[model samples]
Structure formats: C-alpha cells, structure tokens
Target chain A: MSLSALVLHKNDNVATAVRPLESGDSIDVEVADCAVKIVLLQSIPFGHKFALQDIGWGERIIKYGETIGQATASIKKGEHVHIHNVEGLRGRGDRP
Target chain B: MNFMGYRRRNGSVGTRNHVLVFPTVICASSVADMISRAVPGTVSVTHPHGCGHLGEEKEHIIKTMVGFCSHPNVAGVLLVGLGCELITPELIAGEIAKTGQRFEILSIQAEGGTNATVEKGKTLAAGLLEEAAAAGREPVDISELIIGTNCGGSDTLSGLTANPAVGVAADILVTEGGTVLLTETPEMIGAEDALGRRAADEGIEKRIREITSATEVLAKRVGVDMRGSEPSPGNIEGGLTTLEEKSLGAVLKGGTSTVRQVVGYAEKPTEKGLIIMDGPAHDAVSNTGMIAAGAQVIVFTTGRGTPLGAPIAPVIKVSSNSGIYRRMKENIDINAGDILEGKDSIKTIGERIFREIIEVASGKATRAEVLGHNEFAIHSLGLSV
Candidate 1:
C-alpha cells in the first residue's frame, strides 16, 4: 500500500498522519521495497503518530531522532499510537 | 528611522505618555480602574495578590508594582490602596517618587470610603493626563531601546526560521548596545547546559542553573514532569517532540548575545543586552513580566500564531511558516518563512524585522494593537487568597 499519510523516517518503524484517516482505510505508504498498504487499526488524527514496527513496554519511542516518550504496552505494526500506548517518562533521570 | 515619542527627564523616550493608575491591593483595583476610565489615556493595572504573601513574594509584588509605575512607558502614576493591605499606599507612593515623576495616592480609609477615594483618584488622574501630554519626543539612540523576545506555539519551522531570524535581529540590537529581555524560565529546562555555555560570567551561568533547576525540582515535587507537559498538543502536531527539542528552538529567540543578567519575575532589566526573566511559560503572564520589566517593544514569534499584546508596549508578531503567515496575515507583521522557502537568509529577514521594530517604535501599529488585543496579566509568585 502506497501510504501518503506519514513517513517517520527512511529507516524508522512508524508513520504519522499528515491528515486524519479512519480505521480500516488503506493508504498507500512508501516503505521498504515497494508501496505498502497500511490499513488503519484506529482512526488517526492529524499530527498523531502510528507504529511502523512492534514496540514493547518501557522502551523509548523515537521521533525526530529524539525520545518523546516510552511505550506503555506492546504495539504492533501499523497500530494507532497516542497517549494510551505511550506514557510520560518522568523522574527517569536522563535519556540514553 | 525616527517616529515622534515622549522624551522623559531620565533620557528615555516613550511611545505613549500614558498616565498609569496602579492598585497595590485588589480592594483598590476598582477605584484605580474607575479613575483610569474617567480620564482618557490613563491605564489601570490590577492584580489579586498584594495582600496574602510573605518575604520574597511580598517583595516581588512591591517591586513589580514599582517597576510598572517606573516602566518609562508611563508619564505619571496614581497609586490607590485600601490603607490596611500588606502593600501600603505609602510604600507604593515611595516607589513612584523614586522615578521622579508626578504621582498621587489615595487610601480608602484616609479618603473616608471607596466613593471618596474614587473621586480623589479621578482628580489626580485628570491632572496627570495634562502633565504627561506636555512631555515631548526627543531623538534618542537605538541603545536606549529595551526589547523583549518570546516564542509561542512553536513548530518545526520555529527553530529553523522565525527563531533564528529573531536571533539575528536580537544580535543586531544587542551589538548596537540595546537591551533585550528573554524569558519563560521553564522553557529553558533542557537547554541549561547550552545556555550556561553562553553565559557572560560564572555568576550568570550559576544563576541560569539555579533558576532552571529550581523550576525542575518544583515540578517534580508537584508530581508532574516539566518535559511531559511541554510540546503541547499543538506543538506536537507542528513536529516538536521532546521538551529539549522544543527548548532548543525556543532559546533561539535569545540569539547568541551574552547573558547580561537574570531577573525575577516582574523585575526590570537594569543592564542592557540579553537578560533572562524567571517567568512561567504561559504567554499572558510572561509577556506581562517583560512589559513590566520596561520593554518598550516586544518581538513575539508564533508558529501557530497568537494575538496577545500589552497595554503599553507594542508587540510585533513573526511567523515561522509561510503557510501560517499567508493564512493569518492580519495577525502576523513579518514572515520568517522565507528562510524555509529558501527565498531569503536569516540575515535578510532579520534586517526586515529590525526595520519593523523601528517602524513600530516610531508609532506603527502592530496587528495586535490594530485589533485592540491589549490583554495584560502579571505573573503571581504566591498563593491567591
């Protein structure tokens, strides 16, 4: 699927919506090899990120090559990512 | 490059010869407001904090009240008090006296009551208006100008464009011996080390560390992380992720000028160059702190755009993205988006902004001023009663 929504990076594992998209709508997203069909698992609003790869709890989520937050639960490929799946890492000292 | 302005005895040039009426205590705010309203070109600044504070907070309130009256923008002052408030009208009167300007005081108890106080205040205000109007404009050097820098609703383009452009303008102003006040202490959280490296002296570096660390520790005590609360929903949408990332862009509004001094909230900058004010990241209170600090003009960068303005000082709006600039042309005065579009360099835009600053200083109305968005608020240091 050729996805025109978000491209996290050339080597990253998530995409953000440039605009809002509904769940189950397939968008053509450019990834590795050819255009990949990304089916929205949940409605993604504009500017919100989505998982490009599987993420685990307590692991850092990198956006713009910086740590934005940590994954709270396991997130699969193309899953809608937001506050529910990511938790604020307070008093965690510093990011590595 | 010069517009007519009111020249003060202190060698400061004022854009407006406003008669300021300040209520030291909340109880006297109504009287001050009534007095200000009764006289044209008079302003009333009222806040709810002068009564229930102690030590440093009490001192902060008094200093702020003093600073506002001596702001250089005001031609004269009228201090109203409830007589029994912690900040006495006498003390407030003393502060105004130090400025060597015309001022009068009225206490509710001394004047018999609120009605009497208001009448007394109205008479005083009317007299002040005529006196201030007599103060004529004289030619003053650019060095006499104290400008404040702020960025709000930041986006990816903020750091890359608007902020750097502002930095250039600030650099020009600073090099020319003008003063620039850079504030929003919380926004400096993640960039302390970088800021420290730019500090002019060890004492300034230490002050920067102390203020940033103090805010961080306070946030931790409140069970909230400063980093998490930053990059608000709007900021995230604009491509900012971490607090550190947002701060890097935010601090660019300060330019590469040496950290001349660090001031507490509402404290005026005594020295010229780039001074940091310890204030909340909120625009309303922070802008008020800068205005109170004697900023005659303010250069505000907005990635998402804001219409906030000060009652006395003129606020110039700069936008990072050309898209937003095109969409909100009325709210934005200058567009730094040319940097993003590769149409111009930072220096080019900086010159344009510098010209606008002079133009506004010469009496050009900013978008906010044109829209009458003179919302003002002073940052509170202690608990409200």
Candidate 2:
C-alpha cells in the first residue's frame, strides 16, 4: 500500500502527512510495521501532522520520538494537529 | 579514502588555496575589496564589525578575524585597517603570525588615503597570491577533513528527509575517523536532554545544558521571544509549528556519534567526532563560525532554498524536497526529497551525500561556490558600546 503519512518513530502518536489529505478521505499509514487505515476528519495539508490515536487535553504530543508540545484540546484520531490545538512546551519564557 | 588537498605549512590540509584580503573594520572594507579585485586569486573578507565593541564582544571579533586569517583554507592574509578602530590591524596580524602563516598589514590612515591604501594593499595581495599559487594539492587522508553540518530554511520534510540523510552521512564520516561540527545552540533548546544523552561524558553533558539554558536566557533578556524568531514566518509557512519540532529534526544532522566536546564561537575542536559549536540560529553567522573553526567543507540542508555560501569553504546545498530542488536546480546540489517520493531510500541518499563530500573536498565546485555566494557573518555576544 502506498503510504500517505509517515510515522517517524515507533512511539510517536502522530504521523506527518506526506501528501495533502482532505476531509472524508481514507488513507493508508504504516505504523510500526503495520498498515492502518485512517479517515481524515479535516483537511490536513502536506507536511502537517495528524493524530494517530485519540489524544486527551493537556496530554503530551510526541513527534520524532520526543515531546514537541502538549495538546491544548482533546484531539480525535485523524484530526489535524497544529497551533490551534497544540501548545509548544519550550522557548516560552513563561515555561521552565 | 584519500582526496587531493593543499597541504599547508603548519601541517594542516586545505581544500582551497586562497590569498585572503581581510578588512579589520567596516571602514576599510572598500579598500580591501578593491585590493582583492585588483589581485587575481585573492578573496576579500568584510563585515560590519571591529569598532564600538565592548569587552567580550571586542575579544570575539578579534578572535574570529584571526581565526579566519589562520584558517587552513587561507594560504596567506593581507590585513586592512582604518588605524583608529578598536581592533587594530597589528593585533589581528599578531594572532595570525602565531600560526606561522604569511601575513601583511596596511592601515588606511597610515597609508594617506583610500587610493594609496588600495594601491599598497594590491601590491601586498599580489605577493600573497603568488605565494598561495605555489602551494599544490597532494593526496590526503579523509580523516584530515573537518566537515560542518547545518540546516537552514528548514521545514517538515527537513527532519524527515535531508536532515536524517545528512545524519547517515555524518555517521559514515565519523566511522571513517573524520570530524563533524554541528552548530546553532539556540535551535537545540527543547532537544537538549535527548542530545545530552549522546555526550561522551557527564561533564560534556552538563556543558550542553548550561549552553542551551544560557542561550534561552540571552533571548529573554533581549525582550524577544525565541519562539517567534525561531519558527520564522518562512518556517511556519513550510509547516513547522514549534521550536521543539524544529529542534528535534535539527539534532538529527549530528548523527549518533558521541558528543565529543562543546566549543565556543569560532573555537576549533581539540578532538574529532561530532563536536557542537555555540552559535546563533542565523544561517550565515553559524556557517561563518564553523568555517573559521577550520571546517573545509559544509553540508547545508534546506527545505526552502537559500544561496548562502562561505568565502573559504565549499557549501554543498542539499534540498529536502523535490519541489524546491526542481525550482532551484541551479542552487541545490543533492536532492534528499527522493526519500519522500519513495524513489530512493535514506541510506542511498546518505551514501550519495557522503560521496559528494569527498568529491567536493577534492575540488568539485558546489553550486554556491560557482555562483559566488560568499555569505559571511560573525556572531557578537553583546551590544557594541
């Protein structure tokens, strides 16, 4: 199956969209050597990331096998992950 | 592996034999430029520095200037100064003299005026070029090479494609007993802990944390948000959402080699392997620091294409995506974007880059070098007083 998204690491809960994905579009993803099908909940632009599983609010968001930020709102599988829903955990003077 | 390179008098190998006409102050930049143009095989190094600098800032400018003069790539140097600048031509010449490299100094005030200074500089530069041209390339081992790695105009595909591919190339170089210098201290903020794990010792790991924290503090003190500047508008448009995301991908350019040491800006590494230099996130400044630190060649990964190059080193531009590669074919050298299109694997692209490095070291002209994009800048620690 052609991979529409890339899972950078085995532990990452999000995968980057290699191609632009639209609402109601079903795509095949290679997650941990397994082929999984996901239906897009919203339009995910190329290079943007999408949730591989349901992420609760305030939960850590992992990419590149590291914590990039945390979820600001509950995100469902196939939802686009970006600034609107995710908050960066570093470089903010307010954060440790 | 062996490549043909110029063996310098101090027993260092140089990929280019360039006679450098270095201006000590911004005021003398024009004189240096005119002199370099008058003399064949000479290059001029100019920047907006060398005056109104306080303690550490003054010291850093002087050190970086001297580093450039004594860089292995430079065969000889002609220092041009305004005579009244805080960083005198004598001081810069004194430092370069220690490296046993041939050098000459000219002061605009002492030489009467611009035309006279340029005339004197041209004569001096011509002599240096004659000497520089005498040096010849000989077969040198790959271990003698010091390669610098950097990512600029980066995007999502950067971490996914070009960066990791560069990592593989870095690993191969390390395996072959060569050195790779990874810079941009500010970009390593959130990924410090992960990078620290690769340090060769606890002391080195502690230094990594200290430098990253200090960089953050510096940004906060300036009343600027690092986040806004780091994920620049271009970065955001290219799909990077956070500084952490950019950092996580940026660190992959260092490969898995143990962090041997952390050096100051423009400071050369005492040991080999993957050494990190403390420098700003700006591409030109970071690239200049590494070149001054003795990197004979630089591999720059870019998702958004840029035509940045160094005056002394051959900068091999690697495009992260095929789109940018196709759009800017003249500027880009390697296309790691094939990995994203599933046309090529990371290992294959990595090996190709590794081979390209050897070829460039052996005198292959990179696109930037051929296009004359000699972008150079020095990082300053504090405001010039």
Candidate 3:
C-alpha cells in the first residue's frame, strides 16, 4: 500500500500532508523519481506541508519548487512546516 | 457548449436582462432606491462611498458605477446623481458610453428636486424596462462568459475540497476560452510566490507583487497585522492554524492557469484568459469588486457556508463540507462533499461544477438567487465620508 501523502516536486523542500500523518511514522517519498524513505518528525495535519530537507533559520521554504515563505525557525527533515516556524516575507517581489 | 443569452448592443451576452437604477452618489441613493422599487427586475445598490473622496478613490466609485451598468447581465442603466457631486450623472454616463451600452442619467439638482428626479427616473426606467424586455436569449459561446470565483467562511475543507474544485472549474473554463477572475488581495498574502509561478509572463508576475505589497503596506500603516487577521475565528476552529495554511487553500480557486492580467479594485479586465482583481476578503465587498469587474456570473465556494450574492450577477454557491451542505441547503447550489468523503476526486466534482455553471448561465436560477439574497458592499480605505 502507498502512503496517503504526496510530495509535489523533487526540488520542493516540502511534501503535502494529504492524510493526517503522525510523528515517527515512515512514508515513501519519490524525490526526483527516486523512492526514498522518510519518517515524520511531528504530526502533520491534512493539507499542511512537511519539510523534505533541513531548513535553516531565515531561509526561504520551497514548495512546488517555489518559495511560499521563509523559515522563522530552523526545521529538520520530515518535520511539519507551518506557522510554528515559517512566516511570509513581505516587500520582496516574486521571482519570475 | 452553447447557452441561450441576451445579446447586448455592444455584442456582449447577458445571462439576465435587468434594468438597473444605479446611484452615482450617496446623496441620490434613496431616490434611486425608490425608482428601483417602483419598477420590477431592477436593483439599486446603496453605498456610502462616492463623495468627499479625491483622485483614485473618487475615480473607483465612478468606474464601478459604469462597469455595473455595462455588465453583460444589465440590459440598460439609469444613473441617479446629485448634479454637484464629484461623480455626476453625466460623468457616470460618459464612462458607460465607452461600453456602447444603453444608459441614461437623472440629476437631482438639474431636475429641480428629489421628487422631480424620482418622477423622471421612474419614467425613464419604465421605457428602459420595455427595451430590456425586447432582448431575448441567443446562442452564445462559452468563451464569451466572464466568470468570477470567490471563497468565504473558509474551513480546512475549503482548500481540500471546495477551493480546489473551483480551481478545476477555473482550469476548464480557461481551456474553453472563457475568462475567470480571482480576487481578495489579503487572502493571497502568504501565497504570492505560488501565484507568481502561474503568471503569464515576467510583467504579470511583477504586477502581482506590486499589488500584494501595496495592500500589505497599507494594512501595516493602519496598524493591523494582516496575517494575524486572516484565518478568522471560524477558520481556526475548523482546523486551519495559520494564515499561510489558509492562503494555500485560498489560492486554489484559480486552478493552475496562467495569470493573464492584474486589475485594481473595480477595474474591468481587458485581457480574457485569467485575471486577478484587488479586492477585500469580505464577502459583500469582494463580490461587489468582482461584479464591477464585469463578471456576469459568480461561483462562490464555501466550507462554513455564506449567504452572499451580487445584485446583478447570479452567484452559484458550492459547499465543501457535507454538514454545511445539509445545514445550508437553501443557500448552497452544489456539494463538493465527495472530495471529503473520498467518493469522488476533485476533478470529478469540478466537472460537475462546470456543468452547473452552464446550467445556471442558461437561465436556471441558483439557490441564492431563488432565496433573493442580494447583499452589496464596497471596500473603503477607512476614509470617513
């Protein structure tokens, strides 16, 4: 059986929580078409995002291979990425 | 894909043939309302804006009045104004003239009094009613349809079901060559990068940033934390924990189409593929902006349910949660509950919505329309008139 979550792109540093995911639970992630195993570091609610890689403080968080926001706090791989850490960066224009 | 629609003199198809009595200033609203009430199939929007404003604010009210009259659904327009107001009836008529639409004006001062203006307006509106009645539905292409999408009373299911379903419908309409507009600037705050990636070109992307930043700076100056103000209490109770999370769901209403153009509040879109309008997140105000942008029809997606509708446009309400569907059956038109229930995919429900749009455009009344829900509001820049 496949995991209920989906990671939209290889370059995306985040994966979408299609289903409620619990901390320490393992799921298969197809990064760049190569299947890799990653365990959740925290409970991720449905429709929320989880980090695909280590996110440094103040670094932009990439999802769908685009910067949706920046990490207000450092996030380790497989941890939930949301308001507890990431915050929207205002004033900076979008990259075309 | 064809529907029978009333064809206007300017070659635009109207799903509804309405004789509208629009007030150019707050001073003439009561008189305008009297005229609308005296006539059937007429609506008068009572707004507090239109006086004591300068520059763009004044211009926005004038343009919005004209756009409402030129809307494809309106067969004829009767403008009511105080002769000395910044937005006079003549100026309103002048803007309407650009659309080649049928319009007439009545000025209270010029008419000698409110009673006189009302008497003249009623007479003029009566004649316009007959002219509107003469126009009948003709075969119209789907591409000619300009649709607006809005989401309100959002919950976690909104992004997961209703919003994404709207996205699907938006994508389908664009593929069919129809125009779709996405608005509510504040709701797009945490998700600008995602929208920029969908822009038609570099310029369109830049425009999105400029408009979004402008809204943020304006909100900051007013001492409101825009992001904190997002995800209303209802939204938080329904499972959304952050503004960014809410925005991710909010942006899904546009589907995955390329952004064709960006417009200011009440500015009509010149390009026809997909556009974003600068609008507030409030239901009535945002709906007004969309209607002013020439949207002949609106698809309002809700997870917690809303009873909002535009006076001139037919608003088709789509409910994301089954509980809301059952509870607010009188207000909702379609149920996107299948996505939440895991019975059907988002694409399937989206196609269902697309079909519903065609049906509504073809003269089938929406639940909101049947309930006679015509709530109108305008976004103000906090300028006390």
Candidate 4:
C-alpha cells in the first residue's frame, strides 16, 4: 500500500506514520533514492514511528540524520518503535 | 517595515504602555496583586523568590527584576516589598534609577501592616497608571523589536509545520535587521550539530556545545532522566518518542540562522540577529526569561495545546496541527495545521504568522491577553534554604 508517512532524512532508520496504521498493512516508502516495502507488525497510532529497517538491540535509531535513541529490544522492519522499544542514550540518569 | 510603538525616554520602544505592580519578594506577592487589582491600567508581576538565594542565583533574580522594571513594555513601576526581604526595594531602585524608570516603593513592614501598605500602594499605582495613560504609540522601525521564539507541548507535526513556519517568520524579521531569540537551552540537545553549523563564530559555537552539555550534566546530577520529564505524557500521546527526537524537533523553531550571541538566563543580548538565551525548558520560566531579556513579543508554537502567556508581552500561539487548533481555538491565534493537509506550505503559514506578529506589535491584543492569561514564574535554584 502507498503509505502516508514521512522519513525526515535519507539516513533515518525510521518513518513517522502520518495517520493511524494497523497490523498487516503493507506500506511502500521511499527515502532518498531507495524504495522499499514493509508490512506492519503491530498497530501504530497517528504521529508514531515505525522502523523502516530492522534495528538490532542496543543499536542507534536514526532520524533527521541524528541518533534519537538506542533500541531496547530487537526491532523488525515496519514494527512500532516507541518508548517501550527505544530508550534515550542521553540524559540517562537511571544508569551509573 | 515599521510598527507603531510607545517611545520611551530611555531610548527604547514599548509595544504596550503598562503601569507595572512589581513585587520584590514572595512575601509581598499578595500585596502587589492586590494593588494591581485595585488600580486600573496596571499589570502585576509576582514571583516566589526574594530570599535565601546566594551568589549567581541572587544575581539572576536581581537582573530579572531590573530587566522587568526597565522593560520597554512598562511605563512605570510600583515596587512592593516586605521590608525584611533580602531583595530590598532600595537595591532594586538603585538599579532602576540608572535605566531612568519612574517608580515608587512601598514596604509593608515600614508602612506598619499589609492594609496600610496596600492602601499606600493603591495610591502610588493609581498615579503611575494615570501617567501611563497619556503616552501614545509612535511609528518605529521593525528592527527595534526583539522577538523571542519558544516551542512547548510539541508533537511530531511541530518539526514539520509550526516550528519551521515560525522559523520562516524569524528569518524575515532577522533579514529586516530586527532581532530574534531562540531559547530553551535544554531543547538544543540533539540538534546541537545542526545549530552549531549556523553559529556566527567560534565563540558562539563553543557556547552552543557548552549549554547543551550543561543540560545533560544537570539531568544526570538530578538522577531523573530528562526523557522522563521531556517527551512528556502529552508528547507521548502525540507521537513524540524520546528527548533527542523532541530536541531535534523543538530546535527547528530557531529556523536556520547565524547565532549572533549567547546570553545567560534572563540576560539581554548585546548583539542583535539570532541570539540564544540559555535557560530551562519550562514554559512559564522560559517565557519569563525571554520577556525579562527585552523580548516585546513572543511567538509560541505548540502542538499539544497550551494557553500560556506572559504577564506583559503578547504570546502569539501557533498550532502545529489542526486538531489542537480546533480544540483550543480560543487560546490559539494562528493555525499552521493546514500544512499537514496540504492546504498550506510552511513558507505561506510562516508569512501569515509574520503578519500576525506585526498586528500584535502594532497593538492587537492576542487571544491570551483577551482571555487574561497573566502567568509568571522565576527559574530558581532548586534548594530553598
């Protein structure tokens, strides 16, 4: 399906869903010169983010050509990426 | 471009001619409030500090008080004190005298009691208000205006729509030789690299990194992850995922401009163009700092919706998306949400915001002003004792 989503930068690993997206919906997204299709693994609310490609555990999640956070768990392409799965690497007072 | 403004004897311009009821300390806030309420044409500004501060914090408080008293927006001031407070009216007066501001001081202790002080304050405030009413706005160059930009209650659309739209307006003002300010130091975290590239010189670039690092140090020292406080509950609901993401989006309100100077909290910029005021991200505290730093008007962008406004300056609210704009139409002045639906582009919405700024600067009361949102707060050091 043609997706209503935005990938802010070419180097970004995630795309923001412009509208509510449901599981099983396949989205075709183009970031820079590359075009790819990924099926959603979980329901995503409007304005939320989804991984454009598989992100390894503890790997940096890029958006706007910058690291927004690091993944807390392995994230599949098209899976929801939010607080539960992504943790900020900066200002991490919980860690020593 | 020019807007009609109140020309002050001190060689500054005022968008509003207000008689200010100023409280020197927390103990005098109620009396100050009472005085402003009793007098017509006066604005009340009260804060929770006036004692138990030392060194730089005390200096910041004094600077803020002097800044507000000498502010171009205020025509006259009635300074209220509790006599024993650490920040005495005499000290404030000594500073205001240099700025040539007309003021009167009423100490509740010296006046015998609250009732007596309030009575005397009413008389003093009334006189100032009467004098203020005679002043009229004259045509002034737009470059004389110092516009402060702040973003709060942001969402995903903030980066895409309202923030950048406001950025365009900021650039317009800057290109016209006017001043624009980018504040909320903590919000610059993830966008430091992008922002540093636009710094005017090596000193500014160094300051940018220092401020960003300082916020991280503060977050770590406090033991509460900034992400927890940032990307707040409303932000999560609106699709903001993390502090880095939030910072990246929030800093876009500055637009792409050459950073001219970096001033301390509540310190006015010496250089014009796009200056950075180092302060926290709290809406009220940040707004107060900007206003105290000589910002005559504030262009506040929000996606989650806030009715926050300064006690003095006009806060022009711009919504990042249509939902919040419709939900809080009474509070919001302009809607950039049309960009989401392709009804408007960022440049067009920015131009619209720029026009609204001119109208507000030329004496149009914002929705917040009409609704009476006179909020004020001081950024203080955490410890009270």
Task: State the C-alpha lDDT per candidate.
Answer: 0.76, 0.87, 0.80, 0.86
Task: Give per-residue lDDT, candidate 1, residue B370.
Answer: 84
Model 2: fraction of the reference interface contacts it also forms: 0.34
Candidate 1: where is the Cα deviation over 4 Å? A1-96, B1-5, B112-114, B227-237, B322-329, B338-343, B383-385
**Residue lDDT tens for model 4, B1-385:** 8998999888899888888898999999999999888886788976889888888788888998888888999899988999998898888999998988889988999999989999999999889988888899889999899998998887778886898799989999898888988999888876777678889998899999999888878887978556457767777777777777878777777766798999987898999899999999899888889989999999999989999998889999999889999999999999998876757667799999999998899899999999989889888856556
**Whole-model lDDT, candidate 1?**
0.76
TM-score attained by model 3? 0.83
> Would you estimate the TM-scores of all the predictions?
0.77, 0.91, 0.83, 0.86
RMSD of 3: 4.7
Candidates 2 and 3, the one with greater lDDT: 2
lDDT of 1 by residue, A19-86 (tens): 57788877766554356777777777755667777888777765433454678889876787766677
**Model 3: runs farther than 4 Å from truth?**
A1-96, B109-119, B225-243, B381-385
**What lDDT score goes with residue B81 in model 2?**
92
- Looking at candidate 3 chain B, the ten consecutive residues that score lowest on lDDT are B233-242
lDDT tens digits, residues B1-385, model 2? 7888999888989998888888999999999999988886788877999899998898888888888889989998999999899998899888888898889999999999999999988889988888887888999998999999999988678898899899999999999989999999987987887789889999999999999989878888988667656666566655667788878899888787899999999998999999999988799998899988889999999988999889988999999999999999999999998887667777799999999999999899999989988888999787797
Worst 10-residue lDDT window for candidate 1 chain B reads B236-245
CA error at residue B138 for candidate 2, angstroms: 2.0
Worst 10 residues of 1 chain A by lDDT: A87-96
Q: Kindly list the per-residue Cα lDDT of model 1 for residues B1-385, writing each as its tens digit.
A: 2446667777666766778888888898888888888887787766776687777778877777777777778888888888888997789778767777678888988999878888888888888888887877666778788888988876656775788789889988889888888898888876776678878899999999899989978888989666656656666555444565567568878888889899988887788888999888888787778877888889999888887777778899999877889899989999987764447667799989988887788778899988867666766666545
Full candidate order by DockQ, most accurate first: 2, 4, 3, 1
